[model samples]
Target: MKKKIKFMLLVYTLFLLSACSLRKDIHSYQKIETECDEIVQYLSEDDTEGLKSMFCNMTRSSSEFDKQIQVAMDYFEGKVIEHDPFTLKNDGSSVENGKITRLYSSPHLTGIVTDVGKTYEIKFYSYIINTDDEDKVGISKLTIKTDNGNECIIGEYIR
Candidate 1:
């Protein structure tokens, strides 16, 4: 009877720990999703200052960053008509509780930056928050990978 009770207690503890972890993961994903949405909105509006705030300090000073933003704004402004919500892809390496946290680690969000004019692929990068608060997430990077396979890192806020 004593052994059975100990085993049950251990099982309960494991279950609680698993539940807490699951909640934390969900919260992190939600935070990233929200940040991505804001980024898209800023880009669509051609709000250069707003978009610049999301970039890391180092990136903001780069000449390439300014050029990239200008190109993106020219393509996206008054052209984007719809925003598709971001989704996670399973790389098949890490899986837990029928879900994979790896997918959430660096989720890529794509959207149509134009509808009638030339279309551009807008890629948003989601970074996991390293702070003590697990519920926080932020956009660490942005890119516009052209058809020539050339990619530009427009924004980076990873710290």
Candidate 2:
């Protein structure tokens, strides 16, 4: 009877550990999604400064700032008609341990050009990772394009 109780205790401990790990992953994914939403909001409002604040260190230089603003303004000239949160996709197995990984895909946004009476779809990709200090989330590899297949902006940095 004592042996059975010990075995059950061990199993319970393992289950609790797994649950904790799963919770952490879900939390991280939600955080990433929230960050992506903020990006969409900034772009939709043409808030260039707010959008630039999301970039990572490597790409957030004075020289690149104005250009970044231009690209966003040019791509999203009119008010945003629709915006969607980024969806996570499985990125396949990692080589190190064959662990299944997930990544954020390009979120979709649509805007109407009132001047031309044309609607445009904007798709942009962002990668989020935990910073070295583990206190902040870092964002990088921002690439934006229009429905016409024009690569309007590409950001290389993490913030």
Candidate with top lDDT is: 1
- Candidate 1 Cα outliers beyond 4 Å, as residue runs: 77-79, 89-104, 111-120, 126-140, 145-152, 155-159
lDDT score, residue 90, model 2? 29
How much is 51 displaced in model 1, in angstroms?
1.0
* Cα lDDT computed for each candidate against the true fold: 0.59, 0.55
What are the models' TM-scores? 0.66, 0.65
Candidate 2 has a TM-score of 0.65
> Which lDDT tens digits does candidate 2 get at residues 38-66?
76667667787787777655556547666
Task: Please write out the lDDT profile of model 1 over residues 1-159, one tens digit for every residue.
Answer: 999999999999999989977786677677667766666778667788787776544556666777877776664535467656666642112345655344334445655555555444556654443233233233446776544466656656443
Residue 153, candidate 2: alpha-carbon lDDT:
62
